[model samples]
Target: MPSLLAVCAVHALRPDSGSVGVTAIDKRPLDGEVRVGPLGVRADVQASRKHHGGPDKAVYAYAQQDAEYWERELGRELAPGWFGENLRVEGIDVNAARIGEVWRIGEKVLLEVTMPRTPCATFARWVGGAAARGWVKRFSEEGRLGAYLRVRRAGEVRAGDAVEIVSSPLDAPTVLEVYRS
Candidate 1:
């Protein structure tokens, strides 16, 4: 069954770490129940509101499988939340989830699939060095980008919770489809 692997929140804002000269992208796994609000995780913060943190992009979820692929390519480990995702999931392809898909996480917290995460200069800067070279272009080409979600129902969430894909609109575009376009 599809399940949550990790629940994370921003550890702190690094004032000198991103394209905008600040970022909350370096997340850390959180223990116990983490509150999910309309804007995002209770303990999380986005440094650049112009590019992140809104009703339509409240929570980011990435596939553990996708992270594994990166680990192999980068020759290093990618711990959960490494991609700045609030949730790291397994047993489901986040990129394949249809837009407008509704997911029931645990017994609470409903999240509607919104869009694919777009790689940006902030991401490239966060990566740095050899991996950062042509990163935006390479990431765009790979199409392993994760899904952004809108919080439909807020609740406390924890790792090990089941993720049920409850519904989706008919003929809705997949995350990958949106990313490729």
Candidate 2:
């Protein structure tokens, strides 16, 4: 049955760090919904043309392996262990999620899947990976990693919360399809 998964920490830029304690948000399925939650909460950070905060800008649960090259390229180490995703889902398959899908965290907070995450140069440098570009490209091709989402509702979220899918778009598109087009 559909149930809430582990609410992961939300971080920006740095993979070995954490930010915004988002826990216990409510996520339920719904119909005829476009903007699932709210804005600013899941909205992208415009700092230096980069997106931060919110679920959309959140990193995936385990997409850092591809960034293995960074360890060598940058001569540094990455942290956060294995749980790479900002949110660790138990039931819902993040990769299978479609664009415009909304997830409720706790009672007031909400998040909607917008588009698949596309890595930037900063991420490559962090991991010290040389072929960072190729790693990102392969990730898109495999569709193993999930997509970026925007915040529909702004609130606090934490772990051990139910992630109820409130809405999902019809004719759901794959991350690759969405990214390619």
Candidate 3:
């Protein structure tokens, strides 16, 4: 059984030079249950709505396994939400999750895997420095970019909740495949 390791949310902010401000992709774990609504996790903000946060991209979930891989590669420990994921999931192969796959969290919140998060300038800037390019290239090539999900049923969610796979459509491209392509 997969489990929710953490739930995170962040505030939107303006970048130093760019006309478009960046949502400081810094997400911190919530202490208790948080509401999941049609748009997304309540109070969560996405600076770039053209590329993120919509009915098809309401929530973002990253697998702990992928984070562990980055930790090994970067030679640093990464906590949940380090990659700006709304939910840090453990014991699940997020790369293999298919588009349209449905997952139930806790009792009522339901989410459907929709797509893979595309790397953006905001992400690069958030990472900062010369290492950003390398990180982007490697992440793109590796295809472990994590899955974007749409809210199927609005409810409360929190860490330690069980993640139940309600449906996984056949013939749908996996999240990793979508990322790689």
TM-score of every model versus the real structure: 0.97, 0.56, 0.93
Poorest 10 consecutive residues by lDDT, candidate 3: 11-20
lDDT of 2 by residue, 10-63 (tens): 333333221322321222222221222333323222232234444456434333
Per-model C-alpha lDDT, please?
0.91, 0.49, 0.86
Pairs of colliding residues, candidate 1: none
Error of 2 at 37 (Å): 9.9
Model 1 per-residue lDDT at 148:
93
Q: How would the candidate models be sorted by TM-score, starting from the highest?
A: 1, 3, 2
Question: Which model scores highest in TM-score?
Answer: 1
* Worst ten in a row by lDDT for model 2: 24-33
Query: For candidate 2, what is the lDDT?
Result: 0.49
Better of 1 and 2 by TM-score: 1
Give residue 152's lDDT in candidate 2 (0 to 100).
Answer: 69
Count clashing residue pairs in model 2.
Answer: 43
What digit string (tens of lDDT, one per residue) describes model 1 on residues 6-95? 899898877665557788889989999889999988988888888788999999999999999999998999998889999999999999
Prediction 3 global C-alpha lDDT: 0.86
